[model samples]
Target: MSASVTKMVPAAVILFGAMGLGGCATKSYVREQIAPVSQRVDALEAKLNETDGTAKSALSQAQAASGQAQNNGQRLDQLNARVDGIEQRMAESQKKKPRN
Candidate 1:
C-alpha cells in the first residue's frame, strides 16, 4: 500500500501542474484576442478626426458667408440713399416746369 501511495502522489502532482499551466494564457493568445479590438479603436479614432475636420471646414465657410451677407446689406443701404436723393430732385424739377 505504501509503494502504491508513493507512485500515486507523483502522478497526482504532475496532473495538477499540467492543469495549472494549461489554464494560464500565453502572450501570443492574449495578442490574438486583443488585436481586433485594437484595430477597431484605431479605425474609430481616424473617423473621429475626419469628422472634426469636416465640422471645422463647415464653420469656416459659414463665417465667410455671414461676412459677405453683411457687406451686401451695407451696399444695399447706400444704394437706397442714392435712389432717394434722385427721386427728390426729380420731384423738384417737375414742380418748377411751366404748364402747357
Candidate 2:
C-alpha cells in the first residue's frame, strides 16, 4: 500500500502540472480569436442602420403619395360636379329652342 501511495504522488503531481500549464490562454491569443467576430458584429450593425434609414425614407414617400392622391380625388369630384351643372343648363337651353 505504501509503495502504491508513493508512486501515485509523483503521477498526480505531473498530471496536475501539465493541466495547469495547458489550461490558461494569453490575452493576445484571446484577442486574435475574437477579432474577426467583433468586426462581423460591427459590419452587421452598420448594415442594419442603413436599412433602417431606407425604410424611413420609403415610409415618408408613401405618406406624401397618399396625401397627393387624396387631393387629386377631391379635385376630380369638384370637376365632376361642375360638368353635371353645365350639362343640365345645356339640356334646358336646347328644350327652349324651336323644334326644327
Candidate 3:
C-alpha cells in the first residue's frame, strides 16, 4: 500500500502541474486573440471622434454661410428697390421733355 501511494503522488503532482501550465497557456492565447480586437476598437473609436468633430465643424460653417447668404439677399433687395426708384425718376424726366 505504501508503494502504490507513493507512485500515485508523483502522477497526481505531474497532472496538476500540467493542468496549471495549460491554464496559463490558454490565458495567454486568449489575451493574444483579444488584443487585436481591442486595438481595432480603440482605433475605430478615435476615428469616430474625429469624424464627429469634422461634422460639427462642417455644420457650423454651413450655418455661417447660410447667415451670410441671408444678409446678402437682404442687401440685394435694398439695391433692387433703389434701382427701381432711379428708373422711375429717369422715365418721368424723359416724359417731361418734348421730342424733336
Give the candidate number with the greatest TM-score.
2
Ranked candidates (TM-score, high to low): 2, 1, 3
> Model 1 off-target regions past 4 Å?
1-23
lDDT accuracy of residue 41 in candidate 2: 97
Q: Count the backbone clashes (under 3 Å) in each candidate.
A: 0, 0, 0
The segments of candidate 2 whose C-alpha lies over 4 angstroms from its true place after superposition are none
lDDT of 3 by residue, 13-74 (tens): 99999998776657688899999999999999999999999999999999999999999999
lDDT of each: 0.98, 0.99, 0.96
- TM-score-wise, the better of 2 and 3 is 2
**Stretch of 10 with least lDDT, candidate 2:** 1-10
Query: Which parts of model 3 are misplaced by more than 4 Å?
Result: 1-29
Order of quality (lDDT): 2, 1, 3
Give per-residue lDDT, candidate 2, residue 35.
100
